[model samples]
Target: MQRIHWFSTLLLGFAAASSAQQAAQPAPAEAAPLSAPVGTDPVVTQPAAAVEAVTNVVDRAADAAEPAAPAEAAEAPGQAPVQAVVPGTPAAATAAVAGSTAPREGKIPALDSRLFPRYDSLQPKVAFWTKVFGQYSENQSAIHSSTYPNKVFEVLDFRADAMRLDKLALARLKNDEETRAKARYNRLLEEVDRLRDSPQQLNEEQRRVWQLYADVPGERRFRDAVGTLRAQRGLKERTALALETSGKYMPAMESIFRSYGLPVQLTRLPLVESSFNVEAYSKVGAAGLWQFMPSSAKIYMRLNEVVDDRRDPWTSTDAAARHLRDDYNALGAWPLALTAYNHGRGGIARGLQKVNGNTLPDLIARYDAKSFGFASQNFYAEFLAASDVEREWKTHFGEQLQRNAPLRYDTVETKHYVPYETLRRLCDADDEVFRKLNPAYRPEVIEGKLYVPPGHVIRIPAGHASAFNVGYAKLGSSERFDSQRSFFLLHKVAKGESLGKIAKQYGTSVASIKSASGLKNDSVRIGQLLKVPPREERRPGPVIVAVGESKPSLTRAETAAVEAERREQARPAARSKPKAPRTHKVRSGQTLSSIAKQYKVSVNSLRDANGIDGSHLAVGQKLRIPAS
Candidate 1:
């Protein structure tokens, strides 16, 4: 059966080939194959000849089975007829058709209808399975949302897995960062605490108090107070030196404070005011140990060219104590009174009112109190702190600290102008000692009946009281002449007048005129004020030769030179000169002066010449005289 089938297949394929060939050769008009049928199984064509032959044979067999149409007679010239192939035959013929039915130039690969078909042909089973898989993926993504997209628990699971990978290292890094931050914070806190708590850091007393009470806890107050005390005691040597030189008048200061019933501790106020420098001057022109501004000093303390009582420790303290007492009376508080001392009562009052009520802390926090700079708000606190420390150190240390010695002096009133030099010489007191006792005298000169004000307790050295009284009496006497009186006058130099001419006119030397007027170039203006000596015997004319010899005529320059030489020689020599004694007799009808004149003797010589008083002389008396 296999052999017969093969042979028959060959014979049928040959017959179908013949028919197709014959059809290709101008076949009758109705003999062409039809288009492939719709809904029939489409055949894939192969270009291989053997496959084509088999397909053709199959198509012929199918064709044979179908009935052939009757041959049509020749039609009219323009008419055409259609020929139909059996249903199976067209498919067989399509199977046999050519090497590739796909377009040789432009054709798309056909889609597998089984995998993704047209909408109408889609299988419900496959679509359902695909949807289920997609949903599963979405759920998985949602689970990992922290690390991935579109899953519920995926993110949480991812984070957990990552955390588990390096959990110990992450914890250590976090701990280290926290520890470092904490250390930095603690270091800053320590610095702030030191600044807030260390009173030893404060150099000024005014600063110490503020630092002490600035947020200091009550429990730590005693310790802080003690520390401040030790610090203040350590400062004693410096304070002592300062006070010793400038605070000699402190006794009087204490008396003044006592009179006002104010605390005597204020005597040490100058320690803060000016470190006890009497001539201390502030940048704003506040002067003296009390640091009084010019206006305030003028108002409260005595100020003048002759005397600035502000520089006098006793007087300024008295004034300050009085002012402070008055302020206290007005304010009814010490801290407010001290604040007034700095910012004035009105300013402090306004500041107090600004606080919403009269409260010190509130006023400090709110009001713009700029009396002593930004640091001034704490000024009173500094004073209180300083006072506290001073008291502590004094009580605990006792005499181990060198206490200030009390000042001692006597007071004397004079209703005359007394030169300071005269007082110093007569009282046999040193300049410092005198100034210490009489601090109210600015120039140290008492002019025209000064009462010696309260603080001026004149210091009379031992056994000098009598001498000072005699000098004081002499000061009152009008008979006494000023050796400097002539130099005191003002003289105008003429155009042609040399310093020599002017000095001679006033009985003084050119050098002296130049010196007194501070003339550097010996040049004088026409109206320049020049000092000259007064006419007072012309320095005895140089004792020209001896008294017995004839006076020689001298040129102006020679005379001046001789006079200068004599003046220079008149100063006592380092060694003493031997003395010679001579005798003289009073002549009858000849005055002792006439006899002394013949010998060129002085009136003092004549007294010793005849043992005769210059007031009374006897005739015929012999006297001894010293010869120059």
Candidate 2:
């Protein structure tokens, strides 16, 4: 299912490329080269090594191949096929012989440096910035905090009749020039803010004309333009924040990417996905830096009431890298593969088929599927913008901004369900520090309602490994920290109830109840309290019927007759009794059970009259007692 891009290229060649071009219109800019040589760039060279390594393996496999002879004619005892080994043998010769002797097969070629060009082109740069501005503006217009500061100015150079700026290159400036630049930046920010607010006080002519197009769906024409302008103005601020955040996680994330034999630049993707915010949550329930939805996350990460690994940056990075690797193997192009991150693989594949476009640039311009909305259409562009920003932050912000410190932690696998207080004491960390180190634990778990799940790899602060180990050993293996491990509920014994009958009703063994309650024998008295296990785990067995009665089987007619007789008998008894007082006062530790007993009524009847559902009661509270 995961087809490499090179296989399509090696076999299909021009046909595949041409078919893709025919499906969609040519992109606005010239297409990147399909097979550019890996130059000196480390980023380019790093991936090339992995691709070349795979190619070497494929070549060796071909050279070692031998043709199968007729089974009866070629019979020999324990004879091995001839192993091909030649000093300085060319891969092509080995492949040619293998092709003649057997079916043709080779490793699909790796993504050439041609597809991932550093966008120095004007057309693509503008497009990338436009998308970046669009997404930033959209988020700003919403009711959430943005990583990019709202007040900042973006400086663009318009020389040679073209818009250009080496955002990643530091501007060589004299002391006086730095002073002038700061002054100019302040002025631009003020002007942008003034222009943004001026549109709100629209003239009559403009207001009427704008209203004409107001009813259109998904169109916020004027407001969107203003938001884009604001985004452009604040680009430097947001880019700086992204760069700072990247400092903390990029090293580890890049290591993970390299481990999967993926491009290291993929690590910058979180800037577009969540601005590197570990706590970022989307409207559609996607969470964390990668913005993974619950459905996709469950496939790769552990997600449940106890722990949500999606919030764990370290773990989620590994999952995200693996997912991207699979996508690349399937689509064979970084552009389409990246698009699949925002949209979906199946959708992108269908869009390509519909347009017959093999190239990502072509698909970008021509693919017009309704499902491929603005976000999907511009995802790759946004990623490019974020990458550019991340790479060039030092050039723009200079030494004024500080990089965030890298995160350091030690992992400890808890042996048993540990309570928050116990773990906190063991780690010698305050609540804030503990929670910061362990974001995967839900709020209830941290608040002590639930225990930290057993075998969970907890992240403790670095340099405290020995202390944690000692504390854990000292704590030993104990269930006292877990109060609800078995989840028992209190059961009050009734006058006619026996231990065996109670056990059968509650679906628990009599021995379980005896152990939980520390009972010496099966003896139980009226009003005696006992601990009972949950009902869902109850054993399926014959219930205690009556003194000498066996379970009865009744026909529909007979059942109906018995129900009618019972209702008739109850109706006369209810009519015979007088109504009780309207309200009854509560007493200390006296629950609905005791109150019901005092009035000779069912707890359900008492609750319905008092308009309460739970068993909890307070002293001196008035309740409406219904007549029996």
Candidate 3:
């Protein structure tokens, strides 16, 4: 439920960018925030395999070699520590108890003023974000001007269950809120416009709004700020929880960054991204601790049928370090690199070229491109404030707060491609404990179908390395496959075959079939090859142990077929109501207008069908076709 709310908040942040400027342009007919969807970064073709034999992981845990410190905060062994120096704040003057880890030669500069400059002019903006992290809760939002973030007009308190309400009730509530917001906006516009002319006849509330711009040196200040009003929902409560959650991964995460020669402060970014929700998945397919979209994630980490590395904190941290290292080398500054992380390097480069500015502050003040809106602009500021919130933890969340303990596990490389059952037997692991330690493995791998790749790093409970080494050495070759089996088998779609029949026959869900094939619906054309999951089979067991070796593998048996009603349940119930119409996949050269004309529906209906407000469409994007 919290993840859902965060996803919605991400969308609202996107919509808030353009909402402030609607007074200057024709607004969407609905003008609802959901109209603007936060799409994924540019899609890249995923390679076949992102990793080879070796992993960055082989370090064994020392168990008790490290203790808590102010600088490194190295709470556990095998956890490397480095502290980020806030720009303009001297290392000694800020805070530091003592350091155990020696400084490496030519360490990357902290988010310094030279690379990540904090102009006095942008303090209000930074302070606004500080409040976002420290003051406001998810149910509250502050209405302010996008042009001048400090000119906050009001803070809105929404019902706790506002987002959790049913669609119809939620819509009605949103409509009512929109009406109230419009009325408030009109009254503010009246007062601000009056200030533009009279400059003296201000009511108490109006004067407060007027005084917000007191530092402005122009006569047109009031008039210029008129159309820039926006509202930003707060994540204060979530961020506070994230501060505690961050401790579990922070020690190892900081070490990963230090290994990459990057600043440890980058660990705080997840506070802004997922709020430390490891299982978080955005609607656009981004996932995990770092929220790496599959398109970009595949380039740096392995994301195959059996495992998505993004879901694993340690593996994803390694990928994020490599990713950030590349971004910094390309962009040359943490500010730009961080911005580029959100808006994409191409987008940031374009913003720089369009604004003719090298600094993030300048780009924020000048970049008017619609794509570089609220989310992109606030990325850096949020990071700085997040880092501050962590540094000044006692001042905000209280000194008595208890953080989560450091994650303690030792990763060992597998000798060959193996099954989940075989690996579990090797470690003598409980299913739940094994899952917790190795979160990267997918459901297929967990269910004993997908083969765990060779050289894959599997985490075992601390102090179990010697036991695993002995057990693996006794296992026969027949018990462990020489190579991993593909997760799926190709099946050509035959005439009269429905996805439901094929999925039922294979003991898999229709959703799995569609996802594996990238199908928009159950419909498939004849002769099209689909990646259908192989039927369930008995798992291989240990053939040799305790002075015995090289025994033959046990024969598997045919699985019983599922009941008809059970198979029908795998697909949505067709008897409940009529099925939704087939969706249209946006091909090249297609627009809402063209698609609407092709389907004989209004363009507005097309937008409504897809829950998208704007006309922007990506190639191969899917859209539901509303009943005409």
TM-scores for every predicted model: 0.37, 0.46, 0.59
Off by over 4 Å in 1: 1-237, 240-250, 394-399, 443-467, 476-628
What Cα-based lDDT does every candidate model obtain? 0.40, 0.49, 0.58
The candidate that achieves the highest TM-score relative to the unseen native structure: 3
- Deviation in angstroms for 56 in model 2? 42
Angstrom error at residue 320, model 1: 1.4
lDDT of 1 by residue, 1-628 (tens): 0011122222222243343333123212222121121222221111122110011011111111111111221111110111111111332222222211111111212222232122211122112111112122111111111100111111101223334547566445434433443343234334444555564664443232333234335544423332111000013333434423332344345445555666655555565555566666655555676666665554454464346667665556655775676666666666566656655666666667766755455566577544323223433543433333333333323334432333333333333334556566667777666665456675424432222321122444333455666676665444222111112457877789888778766545675555445567677778777765323221111111111112212223334445666777797767767766667666668765566677776544444323332345567666666574
RMSD, every candidate, angstroms:
60.1, 24.0, 22.3
Question: In terms of TM-score, which candidate is stronger, 1 or 3?
Answer: 3
Candidate 3 lDDT tens digits, 1-628: 1212222232233333343233123222322110111212111111222211110001111110111111211111111111111111122211110110111111211344454566555555666777777777655666666766655666666655565787578546644664566367557666776666676776755656566666566877766766566557676667666765655556456655665677776877887777777777765567887877765665565566667788887678777776777677766788888877777776777778898988888788898877677667777877776765655555566655444544444445565567887877777777766776678888888887767755455666555667777787787876665434545668898899989988866656686677666677778989999876544221211110100101211111101112333455597745567766978999999988788888877564565456453579999999877677
lDDT: worst 10-residue window of model 2: 49-58
Error of 2 at 188 (Å): 26
Put down candidate 2 lDDT per residue, 202-294, tens digits, no spaces. Answer: 554343323322332343333332322211222334545555555455545655565567776787778767666677676566778787776
Relative to the true structure, candidate 1 reaches a TM of: 0.37
Ranking by TM-score: 3, 2, 1
